[model samples]
Target: MISRISALIAAVACAATLAVSPLVAHAQDQQASAASAAPAEQTAAPVAEAAAPAAAAATEKKDNPYSLGNIIAHGNTVDQAVLVILAIMSMGSWYILFIRLWDTAKLNKEAKEVRASFFKKASLQEGLKSLSETGAFRYIAQTGVDASEHHEGALTENIDHNTWVTMNIDRAVGEVNSRLQGGLGFLATVGSTSPFIGLFGTVWGILQALTQIGVAGQASIDKVAGPVGAALIMTAIGLAVAVPAVLGYNWLVNRNKAVMSQVRAFAADLHGVLMGNRKVAGR
Candidate 1:
């Protein structure tokens, strides 16, 4: 009976050991699963944060404002160098236009006054005095009289007199022509070079655009449009400045030609008066 009791006790102990072993193994499995999943959760957190910024950036990119109106309104569009060139061209054009207009008008009025004074019974000395009130026409008439006074002689005795008079007349006319051509050459130069200067700005802007694309790692419209639009603004400004300069140059040139024609006619009329119809061989 004692042996039977001992065997039963041993069997009970063995059953308890087997049940406790399974419980401990289940707890270890749960711990292992939690440890493994912890690393995965930590890794996913950073990925989610990184993805969030990218999504926000994409949204912002969609709302980019590089339009013409936006650029103009902001006054953030044009390059400074391009702006300077445009301003210079514009101011120069207006300056030339105003200066030449006044100069031409004065010249015309003075010439008409000189003609009237001569026709209204002014002697040579009186006519010169009347012309002397204005410098431009005065210089012209004085040049002819000076030339005639310097070369006073008979035709056979003074062969060089005609040549001297012609030279002095040409010199005075050339001086007047120089005044007429003033500022026009600069206008032409501005017209010719403005496009090239703007083209340089455009190229520089394109280079900047490429740099931005490289940094952003994508070539979206937002990434490219800003620089391109800014670049085009420079080009357009250049053309806007250039067109007026070119037109001004052409207009001034034609007006100069007209003024020079009047000068030549005045010189011829003076030559006829001073030398007489028979004395002046080439009327």
Candidate 2:
């Protein structure tokens, strides 16, 4: 009878174990499913975040109102004309500045060559040969030589040899001075007028803004700011064009003065030699 009771208890315990096994397996399956789903959710989150910046960039591009496109598109005929004029002025000033600067540098280089090679020669004839054939110094020297050689005719009877040579040297120096001074006037004009031109644009823009305000019956920031700002851009552009021109003009002028001073000193010494007032080393 005890063995039959023990067998009955063992059978009841086995039945209870069999009933709980499926619940534990289901819980484990759910946990595994959740673990697999978490990785997919994390991967999808990064993709959504990456797309957000691209969307914002596109929106910002569409909403940008102060771009060059807007300035050109919304501007009227006069405003566009003013912009064109300022552009032209800026272009012209820069072109003149660069060209003049190149010329000045070349002249300065030539002056140095003249100083180093010209005075070392023993005689005027040898000195002439030492200078570059096409140089300004050579031209001045040749002119003096020719005047000295050719000053014995009826045409030159009134002027003495010394005066005749002096006159010719002066003329040659004047020619070089004119060449060095080229394009400077344009720079001055641009510098002096660009600001006023820009101010005109600003004034025109303000007038238009006032008209708009009168028509719309409102002085709101949106209405007032856009036109005023665009107009102010013209003034800024004008100033930008003007400042460089002024600075360049002054700089070129000073460089020209320095170059001319060297040339004049050379001329003076050359004159002394031509008139027999001073002697070269070999002579």
Candidate 3:
């Protein structure tokens, strides 16, 4: 586009030079004047070329009131660093959320399978056989049965069969709960701290904007409003980063509880079966 403008300007200069050539009264002076006009046109084109970017940039700002491009472009290193940090936090929060959701879904599916199949078996061995070897319920059932059978060992001399089995099953349940709870703390941290990080960005932005206002020696509303409002975007972005992390943390924690409830229910029933001496004898 600049090239086209330059070409058109050069053409206009040539035309004007041609039209004025007859009025010069001397050939050499006319030549000199034409040469001077050529340099002037060349200089003007460069000036216009330089100014195009500035005008376009201003237009862009006017086109978008809260211009992210302008913010990044004009923002100092600290401002940019804050933006980068918030972006990373947002991304990490989402990644953790996805991972936790997948883990929770797998647990829920296994629980549903347990509900459908594990309890319906005719005996402890049958139930344990029916469960998937990799599943949480299967692990608890196997651990219980193992404890029930290991009651004669020297380690079992002090602990009663019931207590030992309960301890083993409880331990298994706790481990399962731990697995369910793995990524929630990061989510909580993100939620609790992201807004403050964003607020820091907001504060930094306002400070810089105000500093700029001071440098220019003006307290006019437009100057103050534009930069201050743009600075406030940092706070808005921080909230955007923090909200999903918080909500996801609460939701995933609750879902973990639901999964754990199913685990506890199975553990309780397994405990009853173990306490009844279901596997103590040959059968």
The Cα local distance difference test for each model comes to 0.78, 0.85, 0.84
User: Which has the greatest TM-score?
Assistant: 2
TM-score of predicted model 3? 0.70
Clashes of 2: 0
User: Candidate 3 — which residues are off by over 4 angstroms?
Assistant: 1-66, 152-155, 220-229, 277-283
lDDT for model 3, on a 0 to 1 scale?
A: 0.84
Per-residue lDDT of model 3, residues 1-283, tens digit only: 9999999999999999998887765887878999999999999999999999999987783644456676788766877888899889899889989988887888888888888887787788888888888978888899988988877767677897678889999999999898878878888888999899888878876786688789889877766665676678888888999999999999998888888898899899889977776555636
Per-residue lDDT of 241 in model 3: 90
Q: List the residue pairs that clash in candidate 3.
A: none
Q: How many collisions per candidate?
A: 0, 0, 0
TM-score of 1: 0.66
Candidate 1: tens digits of C-alpha lDDT, residues 8-103: 999999999999999999999999999999999999999999999999987784533655444445533346655666777789887997898788
In model 3, state the lDDT of residue 58.
Answer: 75
Error of 2 at 58 (Å): 5.9
* TM-score against truth, every candidate: 0.66, 0.76, 0.70
| Model 1 stretches astray by more than 4 angstroms | 1-78, 152-159, 277-283
Models sorted by TM-score, best on top: 2, 3, 1
Candidate 1 local lDDT, residue 131: 69
